[model samples]
Target chain A: MPITTCVFDAYGTLFDVNAAAAQAADDPDFPRLADLWPAVARDWRRKQLEYTWLRAVADRHCDFWQVTQDGLDWALAAQGLDDPALRARLLALYRQLPTYAEVPAMLAALKARGLTTAILSNGSPDMLNAAVASAGIAPQLDAILSVETVGVFKPHARVYDLVGAQFGCAKDEVLFVSSNGWDAAGAAGYGFRTIWVNRAGDPPDRLYADPHHTLGNLVSIPDLL
Target chain B: MPITTCVFDAYGTLFDVNAAAAQAADDPDFPRLADLWPAVARDWRRKQLEYTWLRAVADRHCDFWQVTQDGLDWALAAQGLDDPALRARLLALYRQLPTYAEVPAMLAALKARGLTTAILSNGSPDMLNAAVASAGIAPQLDAILSVETVGVFKPHARVYDLVGAQFGCAKDEVLFVSSNGWDAAGAAGYGFRTIWVNRAGDPPDRLYADPHHTLGNLVSIPDLL
Candidate 1:
């Protein structure tokens, strides 16, 4: 299958999830919140993925925002934080997370090549739009896809199918790029040629599906495609 | 449904994933590897969950060890640590991970209360055994269930089903506990009473499957149950 379209996962792939949390750490109201940010982000991301998968399996559906909030609440309490105002501020910042330095340029490069570019993420449509708009990268995207459409999360074949269904292509015809190793493996197993954007210098998960390519960041994606 | 039993997630839930890396940091041959351990463990865990779901969706199966190694390799490369010996030592440490201080006494309390105790983990049977044996917590478990039996990972209905299957009870009869908020939600959604062991002081995931209880750590589980 020819790869004519490129789909990216949002959170860790295009957006810096920790950026908002890191910013909030410096807030006057919550000095210790900064040290707690990464763990919060990690817990949120982990919960977000788990919610998507569980809902997918149970055939239940909810927007990513609800899941994101749930994740945040759990994280805050786990950290022994009870300040409602601080929680609210951190979450608001999350809504406007920044894009990684390489993201906009990569998206632009893909667009200049006349290839269809979109975001296939666990994020809700509104969240996706907000992120793309906030990051100033919406103009580079041809479409923004969310798992909400399929009522499932990534690594689920049905969710991946939504991307192919949208683009009018088979799964194999799309290049799925994500900073998440699992999503890369899931997309690969679903038959998409995957590129793992190893942003955090993390490892590839061997047990799932293997990526067709691994890159330091999205900066190298254009050459691979 | 009444919570007759409390099943715990291993790894980050009951074990200190960072302790091994912190210990390895003291090694002269791999000074920086220790610093990289937390990131490595995080990535590996993320991939482990990803692989379990991907394989479950794809109907592809491999043990957790393979997944662990795959995640390690990716983490190593991302951190620019290519030394074979360092990688081996780190991976070996994972098998013999130490339990959290509160684990044994908590398990004893659960057992003392005549409640069933088990481990519902993404770890393969072998890995679980090694961890249990190394931590000297093996005798405390009524059962050590792995996703290997179901050919899937946590947050999956089938993996949760294994718990009921082992105990000859309905899923709702079990009280599933995990440090991972999403897993708590998944298991809760699956009909088990759930507890979120918020060891890192993280927030609730705002899942449809909210836990029956939220705790800072396993130290208080016996009292709650």
Candidate 2:
């Protein structure tokens, strides 16, 4: 089936998770702490995903901001780096993350092609909005939906339902793009047409849900659509 | 609040994931595909976790054996390694994984101390039984339970509930131990006295359900109990 609306996952898809960490690593002001930033970033991402899965199974809901902070705290302690100010700055950077180089141009292309572009993220509404606003790409979106409204994270069918409900389309009509393999598989399992943005060259998850398309980056998405 | 029972997570906690892959890597007989083994193992582990989470949320049930095979198949394709005999042999090795050096002695210590020891794992019943039997550790366990009966994976309260149900004790009387930080947090959150086996020095999850104790390895679990 032909795809109509295109929904993108926010983190690691549209935004670069390592950019802030890489920048921090290169900063002369914090030489000793520089070595720990990448590990910290990786742990933070791991914790975020772990929290989302745990909360979903526990039937608990918290805003992504809270989870992000919780993950950051764990990472900080794990890395044995306990500077509160540095921790605060790293988190602040997350809230105001820059979009991937291809995001704005790709969104523009999708819009020009008369396709609706939206963000279906695990991010909280405020987090997603602030990120889009800071990146100056809020105007490019037809809608910004978050798992917070549904009280569950992505890969949960109800979270995906929010998109179909809002757009008045079947799941298959939506082309969902995600840099996270599990998220792509989840959306595919939920019956959405899926594209996996293999940004890091990570292997595809070995589950039943296979992506309908795969690309190295979002830059190729517009052409595929 | 003393722990009267010590429950162990089966995979990775007692069994090494990399051992089989390492063996495969060193096989002169299969030199052409040996290097791909680690990636295959990593992807297989990743997919196994993904399937468990997805199936739990979907209210679906499949034995861990089924999920393990599915994961292995996906890993093979993702790595472009498609030897059926090699895949079968690797998986067969998984069924008879060697327990970590500390596992038997630690269980013996717990047994000598008159504390109950059990296998509370995400493995299917048959898989868990076969592994215990093959590892020659069956005599050490008071009971072996799997999430297969509950139709959900660990981090789900129902899976943890099996412990209390089987022992006729409150959750707090049992101390659940896992190398997986997320499982430790889940068991802690479900009200078990928890001990995290931090074999890899990974940080605690920001699960809000912190383990009561953390040890470098299972070598000290009996002392804690």
Interface RMSD of each: 3.3, 2.5
Let me know the DockQ for model 2: 0.52
**Candidate 2 per-residue lDDT over residues A1-225, each given as its tens digit:** 678899999999999977766766676766756788888889788778878877888776788888999988888888788877777778878988888898899999999999988999989989998999999998789999999888987678899899888999878789999999888888888889999999777667756578888899988788887
Question: What is the C-alpha local distance difference test score of each model?
Answer: 0.79, 0.83
Tell me the number of clashing residue pairs for each predicted model.
21, 0
Structural similarity to truth (TM-score) of each candidate = 0.75, 0.91
- Superposed Cα deviation of residue B83, candidate 2 (Å): 4.4
Error of 2 at B208 (Å): 2.1
Q: What is the lDDT of residue B138 in candidate 1?
A: 82
Lowest summed-lDDT stretch of 10 residues in model 1 chain B? B50-59
- lDDT by residue for model 2 (B65-143), tens: 9888888887878877778877877788888888899888889889999888898888998888888998898888999
lDDT tens digits by residue: candidate 1, B4-113:
87788998888887676677778998987656777766665666566555665555768878877776776677677888998788888888999999899999888888
| Candidate 2: docking tier | medium
